[model samples]
Target: MSQPPPPPPNQPPTPPQGGFGAPQDPPPQGGFGAPPPPPPGGFGAPTPPPGQPPAYGYPQAPQPPQTPPPGQPEGYGYPQAPQPPQTPPPGQPQGYGFPQAPGQPGPYPGQVPGQQPYGYGYPGAPVQQPAPPQGGGRKLSTQMQIIIAAAVAVVLIIAGGVWFAMGEDGGKGADAKGTTGTTGGGGKGGGGGGGTAADGPGKEKAPANTASKVAFQKPHPKVTYLTNVVGSWVTDKAYVKTGINSIVAYDLDKGTELWTIPLPGQVCAASRHTEGNRTAIAFEPAKATPPKNFQPCSEVGAIDLSTGKLLWSKSVTGGQGGDDKARFNEVTVGAGTVAAGGTDGGAAWDLATGKERWKPQVNAEQCYDMGYGGGAGLVAARKCGPYDQQYVIIQNLDPATGAPLSQFKMPTGVEYASVVSTKPLVVAADVGDSAGDGSGISDFFSIDEKTGKLKAKIAVDADRFAAECDVTEVESCIKVAVGNGRIYLPTEDHEGSGEYGQTNEIVSFELATGKPTSDKSDAGDRYSMFPLRMDGGNILAYKEPPYDKGGQIVSIDGATMKQTVLMENPGVESVRRAESSFSVGHSEMLFSGGRLFISEMMISEPSDSGVDDDQFYMIGYTTN
Candidate 1:
């Protein structure tokens, strides 16, 4: 179809730094300097027009332009002189587009008292005025102006030729819908819309192709800024990535941005409202940019949402105990306190006042997890050693201070996973086998958050070598969450021969009994791309297929499992899921209310020959 015209030619150009013109002196510092005098002419009036013969259907004389009352600026944002109005002959239409002269409506075709014809300019209509000259009438000299104009003309000619030579794809041209024109032709009305779904694994349904008709409607009664992003109902508004760093609050209906809290640097871990409506952001300086003494600086702070302010901040130096390359792995705020994990161990801080509560073990290089046990206390998991054959030490600290409540060890080694909790109970999972054979058998364990005691273990029969097959360890089951008397285990399956990985199958487990509740034998065994559970139900699954360039999300209901395809893209890249979203990675998928919040790391193409930088984004969906 004919494309819309290229942007207009007489578009006003953007001004320089001061932009058009600077304000006349910073807003009179304070008010009430002085009072002004009265108008020279008396207020009383009553001079009628001279009843003279009209010459050749023209009015007797032209009326001068009316100036605004004294004290107001000459024009809104412009200092141009206003033009005067012209007097038209009786019974003749006023100049076409412009309105009639002030205080006098054009003669109506035929109207009763107090009534007017449709589309007529009535009394009290705003006078139309031309806009001010742009760029202060061209600052260049006369010679420069001619040269610039000539150069611009030549450039446009060349550009037009190049655009035309590049053919219809490069410039405006008619498609099968209409005749070609130099630029934009009117759009053609169509009977149907286009639909697309990514061509990838899994059954994907195309999104609706219908367009909504817009109208001036009344506002919805329950609309509020927080409602769009707050999932307080059955699904609970869920977010996964370092939960503390970037806190996104949305207007429930449209998901508008309310505010964002910027950090000094990229964050390693974060948690939001583990205790109250406060967020805790923990970050370690990048390795190559470590602070003095080669120690990565870890910072934790609480954010106040209402005012978008940092309530408090604390710094921990040489106290963290993780991989020299690893960073702040965990940070949580609860019951007036905050805590973060380091290379050697973890540290706690007073939420209101940034005071060190107590210094715990120095596991600076070990993997760890932290969270508040509902209202019970603070809980954390620290790895005792390396992943292939390491142990995870669970600790419960006093909610008020960093006092140790209890410490215990899970039965299996650490493979870097999440610690899911159900108040009194927390579940943990990693890609490991009972014999530590590097087999892909999934290990699921539960712990008592209040006592840090081992509860139970469950094992899944995944392919023995599949767990170790991930070259970059990019895809795997990241976490195990417990709710409604069930546990959710998210896993991944990669099948393609591509550099960046993709997700295939996900599985769910009933960890309490240590058996596979999901039919993993089936290729369709879906898992959570992000942690998700509904009203604490047995259904725990989220699996994202490859992204297409511009596809639509569709819901899948397979006999027993229910899942939603969060994003749909058309190009292979758009459908491509980032490796950072899976297994021990910060990206977490969650479901709250009817909305699904999935955190995915976005990787841009390496700059010609440089490394790629990654950023996280939250995609949400509403089931209702």
Candidate 2:
């Protein structure tokens, strides 16, 4: 096939004037286009048939250019083009390749409405309005006008190039998804959430406790096989159990190990008490060589709080002589003394020197359990007689001399269970009826530490109490705290129909009258709220029920009864197990300096491929 000729440079090929492939009109009779058809008005003679419209065969009269809109410079508007007569071709489609006049709709369906027809100008196309008459009162020289138009075209081209470049690079070179920013550390450590202990007392009061959901920080510095944890109330360093008889100091801020200390024998009991910078750790050691029979743990020792250095070690052999094993059921250190007591008797040593301070004589009539009495001194609860006539004798003793400060006896039929608090005197004991069936109901009593006088007694609701763990094991049992002139109790109440969905609430009671200070129905309920401590007039609680998918740390305002979730635990669902007697064995949660420490023993089920055993995890979280 023969190739079509190329269109001329600087111009496109002109379509037929009226329609596609139409014939062109012949030149005017005067020849040479009749002197360019005389610009618009006649050349000097007002040439025309005296205002008569120009003949159909002649060019139309030129009209002065229309004024462009405001802000448009003069001489920029192009003259309107005159319409030509239309004539369809013999066999070709009408309007095919044809140019239409300005402001007229094109015959083609794709033409835009109200727009100039496509291909109005072609190579060698005639000018719509003849060039303005030379020297006919025009302001700009033809050459100067051309230069200005060229400059304007160049400026528009540069601006378009700059805009296109900015659109491509404006996002700082981010990918197609437009993601470009720094990721921050989650939780309070990055100022995102939770409570800060360094905020000190009275600062950073928690938000109103009405929040139902909370955000949790990702766990960091996770330590495995941590059997126990003891945190300092004033420092970030906490002592964590390393093995059966070993403890190590760990830095909470840096998440690093500090020092480790091996105990003399199997650690039977331990306590952490802080008084300013002087933190004391007291523990009882069982016999290194286990005999077939019961062996008394008569030896006790102490260690420095900041460092793992041993402060003191001593052996006390004075107790009721018999088959009764001599071991301190509990050990507490505070008020310049380290004390340990059990069924045999109680003893106190100087906190600074390890020298024996005093040892109360053991009597066959009374069995005692000793602990710090709210910074006043050491408290000893003495039990006497059988269950039928059981009575509790509470003694407030001086830490320096072991002299009794004050002593009081419980009304007949009351048996001591555990000391809940020393300051503002709160005790957990069982109250029985005169029937003596040993069906004594458990209750909490508030006493005056100074006079040993009873202040108020509150009965534990039977439906709310959880008797799963023995009261002696405070962590697994119901936790009680006294603060802001009120008593806080954790109770389990059914929320939905399921074994794991039971909710927990903190029931508050007025300490003076034993009347409930807040409505129990409105009290906030969680998975399982365990009282941690009283912080700045607020009660910090841990919420974790057996087989819970996860847990949370919550804060309840003492005065307002408001609750806020401080931290959340997404938990490891694959390892979650059902509640069992040994599920919370010896596990405890500690809160100090705006941080919460949790230690738990988890059991992995036996599989054909592996042995069954227990695993321990120590995890920490910030409160702010």
* Predicted structure with the largest lDDT when compared to the true one: 2
lDDT by residue for model 1 (509-612), tens: 33344333321211121111334333323233333332221222323222223333433322333222222223223334544433444443322222433222
lDDT of each: 0.39, 0.48
Count of clashing residue pairs in every prediction: 52, 9
- Give the TM-score (vs. native) of candidate 2: 0.56
Clashing residue pairs, candidate 2?
193-624, 194-623, 194-624, 195-623, 195-624, 196-624, 197-593, 209-563, 209-564
Q: What is the C-alpha local distance difference test score of candidate 1?
A: 0.39
Q: Write the per-residue lDDT of candidate 2 for residues 194-270, one digit (tens) a residue.
A: 23222134322444432222112112123222222322232545535433355555665443667777775544555
Task: Please report, as a residue range, the 10-residue window in candidate 2 with the lowest summed lDDT.
Answer: 183-192
TM-score of each: 0.44, 0.56
